[model samples]
Target: MSNESGHTEKLGIDDCTVPETSVSVYEALYRRRMAWDFRNQPVPRDALDRMLATAVWAPNHRLTEPWRFFIIEKGSAASEKVAGLAYDFALQRSGGEQRAAATRDSLLKTPVLIYAYSTPGRDEEGTKENYASVCCAAHNMALAGVAEGLAVTWETGGPTRHPDLAEALGAEADWTLTTMLSVGYPAENPRSERTPVANFVRWLD
Candidate 1:
């Protein structure tokens, strides 16, 4: 009936519009891309605070609110461990040291690593829905990061599944990392490209 004091809203990810004059919702989504290149500059603590403020607005089913965050600050000891794990994950997945080095550097280049976790304890359908919600929450965080003058990516195949790594990030036994965000300033502007929206949409009316 009511909202979380100040967080409740009807705006959903599917309800954004292009920013022709201002940074419209559609424009933000359209402009959003997985940032692979991040500048060495540090993200301000206040700015990250704002990003987290916006991230919790994402929609969830039953308000289970299974979302929890693990912030790996760039210079922190925990952040260094994840960086090493990322390098190992890259080597194992890509089968080479070049890629592993790149992954290690990529994780270390950014100033913040916001690990997104989901608490799972239900059937397949519930698990699927909760993940969907988690992803939506991450998207909001990414866009919020951009809007706050930063770049972010939802990394799904990094070192999240490593039980030891997750424990290092202070996750519970049941909470799994669905995504990790390496966020910072743009080292270089990304090339613009995307699949046409019409290819993925249809008018039913």
Candidate 2:
């Protein structure tokens, strides 16, 4: 049976000798959520690799393959540097030292932060295609994370688009910051409801 998160309950070897392939894809799709709270445990390299691999498979017109991913693991020097950037960015805003410190601490506690960007295309149409392709790639990665039993959130806000963050990521001035994914084990199970298919879909024959 499935749980609230739509994940199948684990089975012993006697219960199932092989991986459950029949419903895995749909299960991942249903299980995916925008996770805000997360454990500080680092995601395994193999799992991360699988997520990226799926991302590359997303269709791109002209096969520009403009997506770029930058992974920052917890407790690493790079993580600290990024956290510092968050702190500085927050401090420069209306919030003072306290809020800045909290922002820094929150980022420090995240297990992994993956920043996604799209390289500038040659023309306006190409740029639009690249943007759409990168968005698809990010969604692909998010679904893969669900399959890995990891919590993931895609965020795009002032903090994500901050010039300081762009500089920290070594992003080119023209490159577009797509979104940032915060990934880790779930500290809490969060449930979300979606609009019924009938509510959003229209059929014409």
Candidate 3:
């Protein structure tokens, strides 16, 4: 199926293709949270693919589609290397051997580590837009993960900005690391409180 713009529509188990259910989108949005504790079970590949598929559909200025994702699946060689890198980074940041060991264990145990990035654009403004676009994409993935019964934690820390880690990932010098998402089944139910919208929202009119 083609839209008015002549782009062929793709079908999947995402929000658009699936039949409407009793679950509302708002519920998914609210259910999405930063999960710190996760089960050791790996997320299904098809579920991860669906989350990424929904992510790419996020709105971007001029349709630049600047987002890129690097997934480190559990038990892969790359995953081991990245986990070591994460351990070293944590050691540097924490300066504690025990903490670093725990950090490394967590990194190794997580079922999936997704490194989201945005390629630099022509100029500063374009680059900024690219970052914004990828951020939206990450949010889309987070929401989709929640819908798929997965826990997702979006993290941007020293490891994500470490030069050695970037080199290990073979990232280009111009590519900006936006965030890293750790996804798996939740081991603990974390509750969060948010301020009322009226506290932050203002009427323009």
Q: Which one is best on TM-score?
A: 3
Residue pairs clashing in model 3 are none
Q: Residue pairs in steric clash, candidate 1?
A: 17-26, 18-27, 19-24
Better of 1 and 2 by TM-score: 2
lDDT of each: 0.76, 0.82, 0.84
Q: How do these models rank on lDDT, best leading?
A: 3, 2, 1
Per-residue lDDT tens digits for candidate 1, residues 1-205, read 2487866566555765422235567767867766778777889887787677566677888777778888877878887788888787777777999988977777776788899888884777777777778888888878776676677877777556554777677788877678988888877788676798899999998
Candidate 2, residues 132-151, lDDT tens digits: the string is 99999989888888878888
lDDT of 2 at 73: 92
Model 2 C-alpha RMSD vs. true structure (Å) is 10.1
Candidate 3, residue 145: lDDT: 84
lDDT of 3: 0.84
Cα error, residue 146 of model 1, in Å, equals 1.9
Model 2: lDDT equals 0.82
Off by over 4 Å in 2: 1-23
lDDT for each residue of candidate 3 in 27-81, tens digit (9 for 90 to 100): 8889888788888787999889878987877878887779888999888898888
